[model samples]
Target chain A: MSDTLLRLIRHGQEQGCRPHQRYLLDRAQWATLVAALADMPEVALLGLWGDPGQVHAALLIEDGLLIASCGVPDGRFAAFSPVRPGAVLFERMIRDLWGFVAEGGTDQRPWLDHGRWPVTGPLAANPAPNGMAPPQPVFLPVEGEGVHQIPVGPVHAGIIEPGHFRFHVQGETVVRLEARLGYLHKGQIGLMLGKPAPVAARFAARLSGDSTVAHGWAFAQGVEAALGITPSPRALALRALMAELERLHNHLNDWGFLCNDASFAWLHARAGALREAVLRAANTAFGHRLMMDRVVPGGVSDDLRPGGDAAIRAALAMVAAELPALEAVYDSHASLQDRMVGTGVITPALAMLFAAGGVVGRASGRGFDARRRPGYAPYAPAEAAVLTAGDVDARARIRLAEMHRSVALAKGLLESLPPGELLVPLPQRGGEGLGLVEGFRGECLHWVALDDEGLVRAVFPRDPSWLHWPLLEAAIEGNIVADFPLINKSVNASYSGVDL
Target chain B: MQGWRRLLWPRLAQGLVSAPLTDPPPVPPEEVVQALVARLEAAAQTRLGRSLAIRQVDAGSCNGCELEINAMQNVVHDLERFGLRFVASPRHADVLLVTGPLTRNMREALLRTAECMPEPKWVVAAGDCAVDGGSFKDSYAVEGGIDAALPVDLLIPGCPPTPTQLLEGMLALIEAQRAGG
Candidate 1:
């Protein structure tokens, strides 16, 4: 254990969690941990979620991942949001779902419960009927001359997921942009409980539809870890292959849309074609375009079909061939550059402060890819692309770099493909485990606690969007109103993932 | 002078001659397109050449359906060429293409959108969730299906219907509307 875990354990007892250490803290210890968060800027708060009787916080120290759990005996606990800004929304979500109040919390507003759920705190020990009329959402007031507010969506103009954005602006210049999400919440965590791990993995795949493969693999890894099962080498390589293909398709889609938002229709067209090709190849290889539900507990559900490797390589080659010309157009286009460069800048300090992951963090000079740390099998340690600018252009550049790397990685996995059994049977025993993977957007973390019968007792799927969404609010602080869409596309935070 | 010359000449010439990458609709057979086109044309004859204008509503989807729906606009799918285009507001729409299981938080928004659409509007439920809360039926937040909240005219079912299936559904929707009227 590291010094941080040792300090955390002094006030609590460590639980028998596989692959990671989880400590159960009392109220006093919880309060101490909350207080220490202010002084420990080096520690990143990975995830914060709650169950009926207790709350758990996943923390990343210099050495490894540590989970700190605190009992909510009185339905209240010390809030970490006062010191950790990233904990504010997580604390709110805990309140809305498990009915636990974060004592001395900075924000008291409801997060996912827009006051319209059938029951209040549906995951609470005793959920009650919610008959109260929903209240109008409130945004933080911005006071300045000529300042006005512009509210967009739970329904947007284009075909997209639903979420609200409140912009405070002064003569076309944005002062602050706050996102109001949770329109897609469907009790994901509540639905996963009590089901078998394989059955529950379906919900994980849908946490964010675009990240189905990554989320599925992460959830599967957690279950396998709990059972102390290692899948066949072929299964591990197949999972990586699916994940890389998913990354390719999604990044191509986003890159196209980013350019389209900048009014560069030509690049959008080319990128869209390439994305379609990638999706087609993925469908041929995995029998599903998005590869949903193909990855389950213990191992992957299917092996690669004959010529699957060739299909994937052909798609990759097409993309590779088009890259030089596509990049030249993007680099030379003055209008696109004007819209992207210096717009929606999330400073390196702010990125570090929030512990932002994925492209958003990497673009801001924080290099943290979950695949490289606490990593699983069939993957070589890879260097994440880091850019210091932290602007929309830097993010776009990062996506381009990641796509190239994904191509290489996918090909490498194909060459080293091994032959073996596809899955290992999971033991029917109780355990707790954590799974972390690098999805297209960033790190996707999932935690699962299984009962004696191998049924899911509690599960939390933490999307990387949780960290990037707040960074987006800060990124759009000073940008012009007209540039909001372009800025938003660059971040492209998932509403459904964060809503759950 | 040199910068301006380099910027405009080579790139402009290269862009002009780039062959189109769009392929014809790969599914739903050409006959379906012709039949739908014939129906649309007949309908247009009666309604001053108005094609189908749709407004998409994401009641509470996982966004997988939305991606396929968006792909309809891409070159390969090219749904707009079939005379169906997505509009910004429900008031301007002839159909409400709804996806996802109807969540309690979004039930009112979905209703308001359907109500705002001009009279003689059709509601097409796309995806397994919107048709009947596919994998999320037991959850407390979901209404199970769009039919629970609104009258669904057509149901296109899959975890998320492919772009080609979505187009076929749209065609069937228009044909159904014509025959029913």
Candidate 2:
């Protein structure tokens, strides 16, 4: 019944956790919260990560976000994965990173550690030497008559990031699909430690390259919130502008790729052209095609160049003019529709259980956009499309609807652009802050804790892909082997984003 | 009838282009191609004349370089027009466009991919990370760069090089191949 759920834990409120509070909980309190999470459907786990001698969980309860942390001085802690199935991967990662054992945790196989690292528990207080040879990963067993296995990737047959997918199939139908990721684990969070917020932001920006602007903005937002520094109005608007542009280009590319995987190359080519135009506009406006490191802690790094608005407008106009025809073609193509309409159906129950966000969630009848709830500045709450089909077609349709909204949002922000300084000096102080931004894929969450010397003590950047990768496995059930590529493209979960 | 009209409208709306949308090949492929052809003519003594086939590998990038690499296949860059194509398997590839800082998990896979390529192979490290680890340098999980795993013939620099820069890298690889001869 408490809006701040941490109040129910009877723990001391941490100081300087801006916009929201993080409570330090005792063992009993931590156990109670983890136990209660299973019964509470409204509370969603935004992130679960390990800090040296403590573990933290970010939860969304009754429209408010709060963090609950429990100290594990002896390297033992009660596991949430027993009650919350979504916490399983995080539990494994915590074990891999901090050498912490989660008592009664489910599926404790190593997540990020493949046994080839130079050191074990790289983020632990005292890292151990890793000398053992990497062993073959154990996948979940599937037993059925005529059930054979198909193994794919780590090095896929396309120009994309790497992650292995194991599929169990009976003839043509996929019985179970398991994804083994972590090929892109570069120890990003460990590298962020001891660096200032501005320097650490580079890691966040690279957390997921496709959502660079959104991730960069989320990182900047966390730093600003931690230091209690509000960026200038112009800086906020520019950040939003670049974020929407990013959303537009990525959406365009996805729409095309979904079709491309379905054997429709025409739409892919057209969509690719439109995406190129958007990238060119971003380069002209923000100095880089992907706009990496453009959003700094205090504000954006660069102002829009002269005539930047015009370039943005031109790109939007071309997209707007061309989209109707593209949509019509997609809609009218019976062959494409046949492949997409009923394929990769993720039921609303699974969507709700996983707290899936972004297009996938919206397509399956959940309309929780971070931009609208616990909202931030320089913009008003806008409409998010919700369709109930829960199929590949519904996902594609959601992308189309979101693309139109992004173009309009980018234009609106540019027209009302504020004029002022681009950045403010970040103060040297310690604090904790969380940032949740709606990226093209979904809500990207970044939680940061700074030391007294203003260096990063610990941070976790949770890409929406973290929550969706498991769902992809669920979505592939019953679909034929050949349709896996089409279904996978429809979901488009980022491999590198979650691997970190 | 409506479906047919919807599909045909775009083609009717815009006629064939007077010029290709992509910029001209960064360097004339002829001189380099001839050099390669001449060398191959001496070494293998087989009739060899065709476009360059590249196989792209993501060692551990943030996926920015992959996006630009994907864009190179788009209508604007149209990398195929420049006598370069991205094949699915390394066995069919003449060059390897490898990206990322070469994470420990990927180091073995990348080497295996390169080893799968036949003789007369070339490797181009296609981003700053692949060049020398970029921002991901000094991370315990990374080998620092692709060179740690395989011999790199060229390095394309940029956090993630733009498609134009990537195309230039391809051209430069061809020139390097010719110069090696």
Distance from true position, residue A346, model 2, in Å? 1.3
lDDT tens readout by residue for model 1, A132-228? 9999998888998999989998888999999889999999899988899889999999989999999999999999999999999989988888888
**Candidate 2: residue pairs that collide:** none
Candidate whose TM-score is highest: 2
Predicted model with the maximum DockQ: 2
DockQ metric for all predictions: 0.74, 0.84
Tens-digit lDDT track of model 2 for B16-75: 645656667666345544554455545553222345799999999999999999999999
True contacts kept of each: 0.76, 0.88
What is the clash tally of candidate 1? 0
Instruction: Give per-model TM-scores.
Output: 0.94, 0.95
DockQ of 2: 0.84
Residue-by-residue lDDT tens digits, candidate 2, A1-500: 44434466546557457777788888888888888777777778777888887998888877888788899999988998877777888889899999998888988899999998989999999999988999899999999899999999889999888999999999999999999999999999988999999999999999889999999998888888888899999999999999999999999999999999988998999999999999999999999988899999999999999778899999999999999989998998899999999999988877877778999999998788989988888769866999988899999999999999999999999889989899999999988898989999899989898998899988889998877888889889999999998888889999889889
